[model samples]
Target: MIEPAARPRATAAWLLLALLAAAAYLLGLGGQHIPKNGDESVYMHIARLTAGTGQWLPLQSEIEGLARNTKPPLLFWQAMVAGSWGEAWSLWRLRLPSYLYTLASALLVGALAARLVARPGANDAPRPPLQVAALAVLVYLAFFSTYRYSRPYLTSAPETFWMFAPFFAIAWSPARVLGSRLGFPLLAGVALGIACLYKSFALVLPVALALGACYQVAGPRGRGLFVLRRAGFWSDVGRVLLAAIVATALFALWFVVDPAPAEVWREFVVGENAGKFNARESYLGKALAGSGSIWGLIPGYAVNAGLLMPVVVGLLFAAWRARSGADASERVLWLWLLVLLLVFMLPSQRSARYLVAAMPALAVLMVLHWPRIARGWFIATLLMALLATLFALNVALGVQALEPSAGGYSAGLWLWLLAMAAACVAGLVKDGWTRPVAALISAAFYVAFAWVTAPLEGPAGRYDDAVIERLRGEAVMVPSNFNGDFERYQFLLPGARIEHYFAAQPVDFDGLPALLAGHRFVIVQRRVGQPPCADERAEACRVVAARWDIRSRQTNAEIRASLLRAPQDFWFAREYLVERLAAAEGRP
Candidate 1:
């Protein structure tokens, strides 16, 4: 068994690892492309409007000319910061907050792991070396979905951060109750309340807390309360509840006074959440979230984000030991993990990242099993990390073998391997803080690689950089064959009023002539369905598309359309849509 005397050093090592991992991400991965999912456009637009007008716009808008509004305004408020800063939002500015939240999450996860695995209140159970904490964080970052979706611009990024922050609060600082003295369980409530604003899944946290409380109050732990004859137990429960109420009130306040609150409420709360229970087309519905299958979410999460195989394999043997006789805190963490698993099970919508809130829990679980990890297994993991970094670097930098005669392994690969081997030998031999030093070096190397290579990988990031350099106009519209392209565009373009015209939306094409009549430049994707020109200038319209095909040179092509008569057709159509959408909600 690990000695208590070594605890502090171990804990320090993990902390160091977290810092190294975060530093790498900040420097190397900060400005990569964030895909423009459909919702991002809406959030980006709303934020621009909210920031500009300083008013909470209804969470309803015209999308490519269709009058539709769903989803809460919380994420919009996040993006609003980006929009309010200028005519066009800054990519770094808009995304930075999300990144920071993610980093905070990493810190929280490391701390929680230390709390769970370290001897509680021992103050000397050889605090987990910072290397262990760093390893946990690194393993988490390497996990697919959490790393991808944790970028600051995605609504998921904010939601994930807020949701997890409460778990951290519960694990690290349990006494900062917001309402106990004032009126209720305010501190806990506020943390949870903000999470509720971020997304619907946040509600699960309170449920978890309540269940935990119930278990404590009714089960074996209750003996303490009765024996003490001190009402602190009851008082603690009251404080927690009061905190919940305050948080609820704060979140509800956002919905209570707005002129269109009812509409926003119905669409966001009822339609977005409740409707998912019925509407198949809704985001969390069958198509998006895998609604009906018995093993839908778990498998999807595992495959999409690669969580299943690694985590499951790592923890398999420890399963019985973990569940049979673990401590209360360990049991609580297991419950927390279960709650996360169950929460996503029924949502008609399921994405790998939807389970991101589980990262901390998973991190803790892994650390619990670390002592039992065979030496061979540890070395294999290290080899994998090194390989991943090498492959990623090659992909990002277009590095190829120096000698054509050489197989996949080139001089660079051999050199890197040798350097890693030398480091590993040194780490193995060092008497003090060897693991911490090795982990630091490893995390730093990957971070540096991520920073240099991610920038040139996609057009969205490239365009964002280009736009920042050349801010000639108000908005930049990048044509997309698919909706995913926009996240990066939104992340990059900052505050530019974004308008999309897609072949997928024929009306956008039908109305294209009018949409571009006043605009000089239009960003178009390759596969976009071309609209027929109505006037003599039809021949002049240019077309530009990204050439992903090797023979085509993967270029972003643009076409210039000739001037046409100011079209009156689409204005009537748009106004008609606006009226129809307004009518659906009985809007004046």
Candidate 2:
């Protein structure tokens, strides 16, 4: 018979998950700032232009220049619908869907982790019925990366969802029968297909799942080569392939109804994913040229996941308790996790963000061991969560609060209270270390949601007030300080015409004047690794100042240049002809 504890645990899990989602939604609605990433700006522009024409196209040919068919239409189509509401909508509003996807992604992680812990041989098996579920929620909630990106408007959120959903479905395979097995894998296929539509690396997820299954079923056959001759292998492979085909068909449904369906598909799938992956050189140079291996941005990943060390410790402890009891199926969980981590770390092409795809597995690992950890460890985790909550509060209140009383929210305060509340829950659930840990996790999620919900500085805060003041109502040639800065200027200063140049490549000295024509205001800033033209007699773009440290100097120069151009309205135009040319042809 089902245990009574299961009902309460499940209820708590659902309720907490709902609460977290609500907080994310509220934060998204409140005065949250959109990321000022270059790719975001590019996407926004594409969306705007698509809305205008009722067809996807680059907004300003000279500015955006890329073929509109390059990226798959799913996200662009979403953005187009969003842009139809009007450009007057706030950036945060435009990014609302991404925020929703992020929250959904987080909840899925919680669910997957819980499922893993509920498996028969898991260390939490003999514990109270809801123990594993509560622990899963805690493990998921405490992850910093999950919290950080949970509020951002980016394809990564959707991509993350698609990538992990398949794994979750696959992990739950034993719960169903043979023909029914295809159900989860099919859904997994569709999710992966959508993920592929977002980013090419998405293919890795389904492939990893396949590899994981192979590794698991390969007892005497062998890890790498045994699958080649197995009878069940072809059947399994066929099902997965069918799922992939179905996923492709679902993805094609949108474009199939569009005017240039075939063209769009080819460009999106082949040109964007295949092109980007195969292309050895970037806009700067070879992608591998300047890239050096670092210990793979793990700290950044940790912070993003919201301080996950406790979860790791819990997972280890749980594993230790279940070591002797673990069965073949239980062992598959560890192997799958190992496969996920290996894939994430494989990309000598590393970024903290890349680790997101494997996050669900990490959460599962944490939850699997939640039952056996010591009470002291659970207490330590709660205190640490509270500390993080406090730090977030200070940043939001002390720093972000200084700006215009951002839309009726104080993310920091909310987050702090959340942490404190979790601490209280932990104290109450003092049955064993697991109960306390679960409570602490609940509290941590609340804290993170509160902290993120609070209105904070986005890319817009980086602008110079003086420059904003000076450029009011003036046509200007703006610096490509970052992607969204100029777009922000468009809103801040009505009637300001802008010819913005990104600093991705060296500028051609010839095209400066025509690019700046009919514009009186100018803003210039140094690009990373590119210092100002040292020559005092420089004729094209003059140095705004001698120096002002490093990153700060660029902003200072941009402000100074805007000031210098304020009087004559004849600001110097920096050349970016080369950079423009490179991206135009889809260099990187």
- True-structure Cα RMSD, model 1: 11.4
Stretches > 4 Å off in candidate 2: 1-25, 28-38, 56-70, 83-88, 106-135, 175-186, 201-226, 229-231, 248-304, 313-336, 344-348, 374-479, 489-588
| TM-scores, all models, native as reference | 0.67, 0.65
Clashes of each: 60, 12
lDDT of 1 by residue, 374-487 (tens): 344444444544555454444333322211211133356445545655665554455343433333444545443544334233442234344444434455444544433344
lDDT of 2 by residue, 1-588 (tens): 227767676557656654653464454343324222346656665565566564543322224445565455677767666656355545656677776786676566656655655566554345443445545544554555555554444576677777766555546553342234467556666777788666553364445465446333533233344557764556666666666776666666656576766766576666665554434644333323443233444333443455455545555666776678754434555555555555544444546666666666666665555546566555655666656555444434433333343324545456456656566455546544344444445444544544443333333223345544644565566555454435544543434566675543212223344443433334444332344334323323333221111121134565555433431111212222111222224533
Instruction: Report lDDT per candidate.
Output: 0.49, 0.51
Model 2 lDDT at residue 505: 26
TM-score of 2: 0.65
Best by TM-score: 1
